[model samples]
Target: MTSDQYAAATRSPTDTDVERPADRSTEPAAIAVEGLTKRFGSGDDPVTAVDDVSLRIDPGSVVGLLGPNGAGKTTTIKSILGMVLPDAGTVRIQGVDVAEAPRQAYARVDAMLEGARNDYWRLTVRENLRYFATIGGVAPDSVADRHDRLLDQFGLAEKADVPVRNLSRGMKQKVSLASVLASDADVVFLDEPTLGLDVESSLTLRRELRRIVEERGLTAVISSHDMDVVEAVCDRVVIMNDGRIVADDTVANLRQGFETSAFRLTSPDLDADTLATVRDRFDVTDATTREGTTTLEVATDSDGFYELTALLRERNVTLASVATVEPDLEDVFVELTGENETGHDGGDSR
Candidate 1:
């Protein structure tokens, strides 16, 4: 990621800073952010990277953070982790304000962040997990068990002794994530967990993550550009645009609830005026005539189907076929984030 969109995991809590869990068992939200705002620089040139964003995560729920580059998603997560101080607003982890009580808030959390920046490349896979877990406050006696569990869960059992530098990018990515789980934190934050790797690797890791989160009853907040990953792993999503939250809901609701039925009308022959005539009564995303057929894709509800088809008949376009296209996660993401590309989505991918 270029510019300030680069995601960074800046905090490394000591064993004393963690170990004992925060006294937040009764808290409803594992992570709570309210009216968060951050601006870099000063005066007229100030860039507001996070603006008035607020969200809450129920315990044991997995939520996705999505947005275009420079949308302040990275800044928002850093704010929650207390790695980046905000210009305004409050971030509370399990009822403890991060800015006011970083130790208490951080005690319950572990993060596998972007670019594998959280790992020590010179260390072996198992060594990195051991070090991170101990430093993050896992007990010395439990380190070996944690290490072995992480290696097996990540399918790195065979490469447990391999140095981080020697493994492929995908293997290293798995190691990075395994370290987060090894910490045994109550809350986990994964920034672009599927940024690297091929489709198969991504699928495997996502499945493992789901199993881990569910089995452990862990609360997780994941940031990613991979819509498929979000759809597969997240219970809900909070979408951002230009530093502000635009949508927050479940994937199914985001895909089905926010969308109107879009229909594609095909005809053997058609005229531009015919499309214009249909446009008078319906919303059209695109209409193109290729070869011997004209195809028009338009947004409408079920009730509008009869009206649209009848209009086509009135226009004499000889509608050959008509079918509805339901919006997918990708379509919803683009519509909400308002940008198709983002640098924050990936860097040094496997």
Candidate 2:
């Protein structure tokens, strides 16, 4: 949906109270995509960008949309946002069907597309926030307190009067985020929100995003390649691959599903022959020796580990320590995708 549509749709008889459906508990999902399909290049060699994908996001929750390059994440997001017309299926925002009523559907939605590009470069940080609030059918003065809080929370209060173009990249990214939150939109789409931020800035953003969503009862869909950001901020994760969703669950569940197989073993009595025998019998992912102590990381289940320990005892190998390796989101992602993946989303623009 265009900015004009957003402004027009959100406008109501009372500007102070942004138009919102009542009783969210009984309303439809914050976002729902059913049987979504999109393809490019229609002839014989047509490229199916999204194939029969469906998703339902609950209200007041943060979801992470993750995928490697060419995984159709971009196309899927664009279709939901009404930027690209899908070949088939329906997209609804807060119970309003996008195809039936684009303006109403997008009225509750806002997006920050690339990093800091969402903000007007010539406008000051506070001005950008107020301008976006006005466009979302909110009077600037009505949300003046909110704008001030957002600027201060994002550490942009000092630069509130400075032009966005004069700020650093990280500061501009913060301004972009602040502008998105300035609006009264209930559902937000953030694509690579931490793209240009430093470590501290990223941390701050993650904390504030979770707080804002909880306090305002907002729903957020975050698309990012940064696993740490996703893990830190999202309540659920959806992984897409080959134009389809391959996995969807809580982060803890995803990691727990692939748990207890990887382990590290440290030994002080690993001789050359014993190490060779151990390597011959098991999958040794990493091996290192420092100051006469050898450490080996192996991937195996409990039974295989028992067998290895038996062999070590017979060969007079002394175990210094053993620890199980916990899988992180990145590890779970690689295991799910079955390959090392890198790059931006597929098609439909970055």
Candidate 3:
């Protein structure tokens, strides 16, 4: 099916509650930032929250914003949404300059920044949805229809009449997402959308976000600490550290670029001859022999695995198994930023 058709099929009921252009272009960028910068405090104590960051989010892509705590991801989002004024640089939403036309720029983008939630102690879940729908300019006749759909899609149908204050944290987060989906903006900014959610809920939300981006052609900018979340949901990721964009690449490319040939071996016994053979053949990072068993962790590239294996075989050493260790985003983050070392810690901007 076509992308638009897919989006329409999986669209939430409240999707029609907000105003959106019917002719979203495949090539048009939903948001763009050039030389974006934000500073805090006075001259001597001034801290740069965002440092000359430049990025362009495609019209219908899900881009993951990842970093350790205090990496300026939040500051970048705030600048894009006009929540925090930039000391310098420019932010444009759907071709509208945010600095020059804040309201018009933000009108095309709907966001759920950190600490932004849709909860009214006095209002029921349905009431809250309806209220947000109205505020988002959904027509009266469509509000209830959209509300029913969101309630069911988010698995909150049973709690429709229940007040928000009584719901659990996960349920509240679901409500907040439903509210944003109800807005139906072309571009959505999700700041820690899955934070504090259970595994099942997190999975559900990730699936929904993917569906939204792929089917509806919605552009999304997601800020998250969970590497697994970025791996599963984002097509590409931008890593930040010390208020700078350290890396930007597809997850697969990053994985392949950082692939390491590492192996773990276990054996019941190790003779002196076999130990000598192993040492001559492999650059062993660690070797431990205990309880009449030996285990070794060795690092090699693809071309060297065979030679290492051949040497072990020549010594009549018993081999359990050899496998390449897969590199994760966390490993790449550390390798690129060097943040794992001391004296280089940074905080996510408030």
Candidate 4:
């Protein structure tokens, strides 16, 4: 980013004070949506992008929005950001109705959507940051220290004077994130923020993002396919399927329900008949054999596990190893969405 860009970023139309609503006893939610619905196309084959979705994000919390392609995640996010007009819904940002007062509602909000496209390719990194901060209702000089800190945090200080178009794809992605932070928006939406970033960069971003959110008491909604990023940064995960919310809970709670009843056992048995008997008596989810030892994954409770062991001993099978199979976020996602529907649905909703 160049100093010239910062100099040019003066007060603009977005400069408005956020007005808090009256007649409320406590602070309002950071984001509140009621009966949100959206549809595309017409005729007999109308497609519903979002279906009566209602969500509330508390202040100073990081929530993850996850879904497969065409699952209405993108549409829901757009509606909340005021980019798309919902057919039926009321969106309120920090107690301010977006429809009733968009400027005041979104005055302290920022978003980085469509990857690195949010940045100006012709502008220098520093200039882009300054311009975005200005448009977010603050003078560039007011956030100069913030811009400097963001540049250093994202390792963009060295490339600050270089035009964004001349940077690498990964560098450009960093620049986009830096610009969003420079705006100093209390409520931020980031879609695929870690896309195109290397492993180190992704880790750095996650760490910094968590620290900043906690320090500033900011509310963030992150949408990404990278489960690791979501698991690491978000306090809660909201999963959607077929335009509806299927699961909304903390990561530990989601996984805890599936952690039990899954185990891996390895044994050396006599023959095929024994394997078939074991399969018939238990739910053999997976099986593999190597070096005359068969490894089987079974889904059963504590009692069933005891029965399994008894049956194995009766068949003269010598157990080699045993371990519990822990379910991760991906496993939970597949279980809720169906394995076959985990990929794109060939729709235009997203």
Candidate 5:
């Protein structure tokens, strides 16, 4: 069956505890992709860039789309934005289907794809903003007002008169973002926004994104490989592998799901006999001697951490310190996708 047919078959449950038709004009999500699939090349050599994928992004939420290289994150984003047509899928933006009404669907969103560079490179920054504002259907008299505000918001007021070609990479990115803001769309798609930015610039961009989402209730789908960036900005994350979603959860929930009472123990006097006793109860992964101190890394699947401590205590094992190891989104991603063993290859490393 085609992607749309699959979506139609698998209906989303309503809050009223009833199953409704997929195209029944329900409350529109900020962005929705149903059973999206895309393939490239031809015949026997065809590669499925994006497999059967379905996602619903609520309004006013910031979501991260994460995956390793060749995992179809970019393809999914592009298809949703109408930049690349999915072979079989239905893309809805604010209740409008792109397959049926591309213009109306795209009207609800403004996006910055991996290499989204606006035209008018010869025009100055301010001029380019004005040009895009006009294209976005802003009134002529309102252009200057919107232009000034975006310039200041994106910290481009100083370089308003500078030509786009003369702007730094970071500045160019800011300008692209400014154009999106000028469009006054309800949703934004940022694909690797901090791909090539320096530390300071990346932080600045992240702060701006947070401010934009909070101040305007703007929904966003950020596709990036940088786990730190996702952890810092996204409210929830959707992890994809081989064009399929492996995990979808809030950042906090994901961390909590993987949380374990793993402890790092250090001792000046090493005891092989004590180690043997501990191994019987704990899953000891690493033991090393460094600088006269033997470090033990132990992982526990149950509530035996206190027992382990008591066992050490009974043996007079010198416990230097005990701390719980908290899991982060990166850990969850690694555990779910098994990408760490193969080495992660995606947008940018954190």
Candidate 6:
């Protein structure tokens, strides 16, 4: 929910032990999508871009929708926002059906899609926000206050009067974000929000987004290849691959559950038979030889380590060092997805 809805929900308390979910007809849904399927092209080469994906996002939560290039992530999001109609499935934002009621469904959502594509190049930052706010149906009285709040929070106050053409990519991004917040929409959709941002700008925006969701209580759906940003800003993540969701879980839980038994093994002048055994048996991800010693990087599950040690001892290979390394989301993603590319096409990972 947006800042406006946040106050109203608090003012009215349910008499029951637990408050009914925020998705009731009267309350408005944060987000809901079911059985989403979409196909692009036609005839012999019809591409099924999305295949039976379903997700329900709760109010006051941030969900990161992640995937590799051509994994149908962009297609899935487009369908959800009603930019493209799915062959099947439904989308509901704040309890309003997007298909049945486009205007009502979109009113509660503000999206910053692609790179600065949402902002007008000729308009000043303040003017752009003002214009979009009005178009988004923001009340005339609340528009000024919303603009002021967003500009300050996003560090766009200093660049308020400058035209979009004169601003740096980061400044323009902030301006786009301010325009988004000015509407005070219940759900905000940001696709690659940190693209083209410097280290500092990326850090600043990521920090501000976390703060925004917590303090403003606005739901956010972020689609990005930047796992660091996703880990920092999103409460939940849905990982998709090949037009289908491969993994869906919280950032912490996914990391905890996906145990990668990775070990580095070094041996003195590894024998061919032993080398063949390790190569053939274990998932050897990397190998290097130096100073009369060869090192093998093996990635395996819980039981594989025992087999690895035993096999090494029997082969007379002098094992030097073995260490377990904690796996991050990028590593997890690489193992889980075949496409590898995380954003657009051609495998240059988003």
Tell me the number of clashing residue pairs for each predicted model.
0, 0, 4, 5, 0, 5
Model 2 clashing residue pairs (backbone): none
Would you give me the overall lDDT of model 5? Answer: 0.76
Ranking by lDDT: 2, 4, 1, 6, 5, 3
Candidate 2 positional error at 324, Å = 1.2
lDDT of each: 0.78, 0.85, 0.74, 0.83, 0.76, 0.77
TM-score of each: 0.76, 0.84, 0.77, 0.79, 0.75, 0.75
- List model 2 lDDT by residue over 264-286, tens digit each: 99999999999999999999999
When superposed on Cα atoms, how far off is each prediction in RMSD?
Answer: 10.0, 10.3, 10.0, 12.0, 6.9, 9.2
Q: What is the C-alpha lDDT profile of model 5 across 1-350, one tens digit per residue?
A: 22233233334343235332244235578888899999988978988888899998888889999877777888888888877888998888887888899888877577777655654678988887777767777754675876787787777899999998898888887888777777667898887777667788788778877887888899999887677789889988898877888777678655655546577778875588888888877898788987778888887744677788788888888877666667667667766766652333434221
Model 1 segments more than 4 A misplaced: 1-27, 140-143, 264-323, 341-350
Q: Candidate 1 lDDT (Cα, whole model)?
A: 0.78
Q: In candidate 6, which residue pairs get closer than 3 Å at backbone N, Cα or C atoms, i.e. clash?
A: 29-94, 29-95, 68-341, 68-342, 69-341
Please report how far candidate 4 places residue 208 from its true position, in Å: 1.2
TM-score of the candidate numbered 4? 0.79
What lDDT score goes with residue 69 in model 2? Answer: 75
TM-score of 3: 0.77
The TM-score that candidate 1 achieves is 0.76
> What is the TM-score of candidate 2?
0.84
Sliding window of 10 residues with minimal summed lDDT for model 1:
1-10
Give the per-residue Cα lDDT of candidate 6 at 149.
73
lDDT of 6 by residue, 94-116 (tens): 78899999998887788988743
Once fitted onto the true fold, the runs of candidate 2 whose alpha carbons sit more than 4 angstroms away are 1-27, 267-281, 287-295, 311-317, 341-350
lDDT of 2 at 189: 94
- In candidate 5 the C-alpha lDDT for residue 153 amounts to 71
